[model samples]
Target: MALAQRRPPGLKAVVNVAGGLISAIAWRRAWMRSSRPSRHWPWKDTLPQLWVYAGNDDLFPPSLVDGMRAAALDRGGDVRLIALPDVSPRGHAILQNGRARFVWLREMDTSLRA
Candidate 1:
């Protein structure tokens, strides 16, 4: 008679599962503010921000990101809204590969140094 044995998933599988769960929770928390109409965050002008959005991003469309960038600028904040060309629709996936990723890293380095 032959018997079948089952083994637990490896360390990488465990980490990936844990990371996905954590990411989902974090995304939910961050997006919760979108449902409230009366809530407004008082942004400081001292803090600089780099808003990276894609034209094909269904989540945060170009128009919405533009408005956000305009709002930040109106508040005298240092903000750069980089609209990538022909990028992934995932939006966040823009940083996963290509020249845009390197550009983002360079910008971050410069921002941190200044």
Candidate 2:
């Protein structure tokens, strides 16, 4: 999201994995919007963006993911959210999970190609 927000020249697509504005602690405390929306979260529709979340993520759970998706859409940001199956030991590490790499890669490829 940080990279995407920079709006570098020729930026086409963005893929965010296990990323969200609110931290785990803040989310647990029922304070998802405890502070101003970070500069990282979606603010505008500069490009196509994909959000990938692990179904079993302990930190950013489904509720948080849904809230984020909703907020992005509300803000007129072009984004899509893809929730994958539980990814081993820690869903948050899906990027490092060899077995799950293919899944996210394939999804990104198809979405980007569209």
Candidate 3:
């Protein structure tokens, strides 16, 4: 997702597995709805994006990702975020557990097909 946003030319598709630019900074915990990141989705002119993140992901919690989603949507970026149930005690592992493959893969296929 981040890569496609950064390099938005002639890309086939994007699978953002708990990845983004705003998550790079973690010193503060603020709602991103009005944050600069919320308005910084550069993919509005590009293809749709698939974002897969674990619910218990401490690195990119739902609170933060939700705001990002809202922001991207507001900016007209085609992004679908699949907030999966807690897959592992690790909190940041997306595919670490075998059970989550079906759900994530399904979403991925749909988003990729778009």
Please estimate how well model 1 matches the true structure, expressed as its whole-model Cα lDDT.
0.45
For model 1, the stretches where C-alpha displacement exceeds 4 angstroms are: 1-44
Give per-residue CA lDDT, model 1, range 1-114, as digits (tens): 000011223311110100112233333444455653112223424345555655766555565455544544665656655567646536546756576677666765665566
CA lDDT, every model vs. true structure: 0.45, 0.73, 0.71
Cα lDDT of model 2 by residue, 29-112, tens digit:
443544533333445664778889998898787877776666566567777888888999899988888878898889888889
- Order the candidates by TM-score, highest first — what do you get? 3, 2, 1
Write the residue-wise lDDT of candidate 3 on 6-76 in tens digits: 76567876788878775444412443333565445444634577888888988888877787677677777
TM-score winner? 3
User: By TM-score, is 1 or 2 better?
Assistant: 2
- Using lDDT as the measure, the top candidate is 2
Error of 1 at 60 (Å): 1.2
Cα-based lDDT at residue 103, candidate 3: 85
- Lowest-sum lDDT 10-residue window in model 3: 25-34
* Per-candidate alpha-carbon RMSD to the true structure: 13.9, 3.9, 3.1
- Candidate 1 — which pairs collide? none
